[model samples]
Target: MFRLAHISDVHLGPLPAVTYRDLASKRVVGYVNWQRNRRRHMVDALTDTLVADLKASEPGHIAVTGDLVNLALDGEIELARLWLETLGPPHDVSLVPGNHDAYVPGAFGKACRSWSAWMSGDGEEGPVSRDTFPYLRVRENIALIGVSTARATAPFMASGFFREGQAARLEKILEETAGRGLCRVVMIHHPPVRGAVSQHKRLFGVGRFQKAMRRCGAELILHGHSHLPSLYHLDGAGGKIPVVGVAAAGQAPGGSHPAAQYNLLDIDGGKGDWRIRLTRRGLTGTALPLADLEAVELSGKAAAFVRN
Candidate 1:
């Protein structure tokens, strides 16, 4: 069985010093919000503990869906790179950016440059850019597709965009991967399903995304950005595909958002008869040990049994 661990919206904290120029644009709003609210809840220590627990589980691979940094400041981006190194090497970890990584107009490009190793496709080399997304990485019998929905948005809005160009490319990738008889796992920062998040935080072009899924199905879809532990399904050419979201990895226990958590997916079998078991684990409180919260069989003859 291939064990894949999923984590997202880490929002790595302990804000780096910000210059006046950094605060001149939309970052000022994020800076203010972090100071007033986020800093209290997004604790670095919590993320550290969560990562340690995840590593102990020894997943065959790890998928981080985004929001690695808070303000997308140059310092924050650098710190995030260091954090990624501690998490695992590029071969073992795959990442996609989130809205916070592209908080300003050019921040996403900077992040791409710094985090090229984790985001690049197999055998892909040279400088990574924003356009390099929807990259493919094959591990064992699974095909991991990284899609980018992250973009700069206006202050107070956390929306993401899925343009037609990317949608077309995604459909092609899905088709090719399916033809290979590999389990296709698509990763995006924003949940593609409608109503997964509020209006200001919604992923635009939901119709286009659904259309692509209908044309070329995926085995599993993983996303972050809502900071809520959620599960949903989308219609696929073959059957229902599971879409999952997890809470922020850095969120503190007893905070406004759900506590830090990650999903461990055990995938076995092949092509037309895959078996998937999902085990959800995370913190229930500050003093309690990390523990299993839910376990369900996502595929096979049994119906999906999910708790919250």
Candidate 2:
């Protein structure tokens, strides 16, 4: 059995500073307004609450899908590192980058150039350089495949790609590791399977990406970008693989809604079968299971959703 804590879209910061472009369409002119007008202080309180809750519910591993920073500011990256440190250590935590983490060309360039130096710390092991793609982490019975989809998106295009090269590398890695029979968990910033928001630029190559995952079996696909909690069951070439999406860690709900959110995936094995307990962050600080959320589960996976 493996317990994993999944979080995303922290958007760490020294708030109320800079006019930066967002990964989505259009230039966001008001960082100050976003912080002041949108109940940003609620987000801060939610962050502190979430962190405290994570400490109480300790998990074997932590997976952060992306958007650790708002503007990709250097200072914000450091702030992100501090936030990760709070989880435990880099070895205990795994991460991929989101579009917001590399909102512009320069941020990607910097991350590529100093990939190791930037993420340097005690007990942290990962791709030492930008050239290293399809980074695989094998821990206990879990095999985590972390991919980089953070790129300099165009003005109107928020999509991401692994391209042919990265995709081929991933295939080889999966083929090699399949015989191990470990639970394969794939982490990416963008959601691959289609949804109401699938037509957006953030999922440009979603069809191709889904095809690739089907070719090389994936147990669970975890991602963040839409800021809404989602779980989709992909019924195709590889039986049923679930794609779980988490909301922004600290972004306040636009109206009367939850201020913070996360996902807790509890997997237990018995009689050689695996059962998953999927919980969504609720508005009243309750961890609501998908079985109770007929509106959220929306598909075949709902039958398998367990309340815990």
TM-score each candidate.
0.97, 0.80
| Model 2 misplaced regions, further than 4 Å | 16-42, 112-130, 196-200, 253-258, 270-272, 285-302, 305-308
Q: What is the lDDT of residue 64 in candidate 1?
A: 99
Q: Give the number of the best model, judged by TM-score.
A: 1
- lDDT values, one for every candidate: 0.91, 0.64
Predicted model with the maximum lDDT: 1
Tens digits of per-residue lDDT for model 2, 1-308: 67787888777655534443342323252244446654453366667667667656678888888777665666666666667667677677877887867767677655444334323223346544434556777767677777778886655456776677677777776666566766677888888766635454456666667777778876677888877777776653446778888767775645443446777777665322446666665344443221222123222335444443
Give the Cα error of residue 242 in candidate 1, in Å.
0.3
Q: Provide the clashing-pair count of each candidate structure.
A: 0, 1
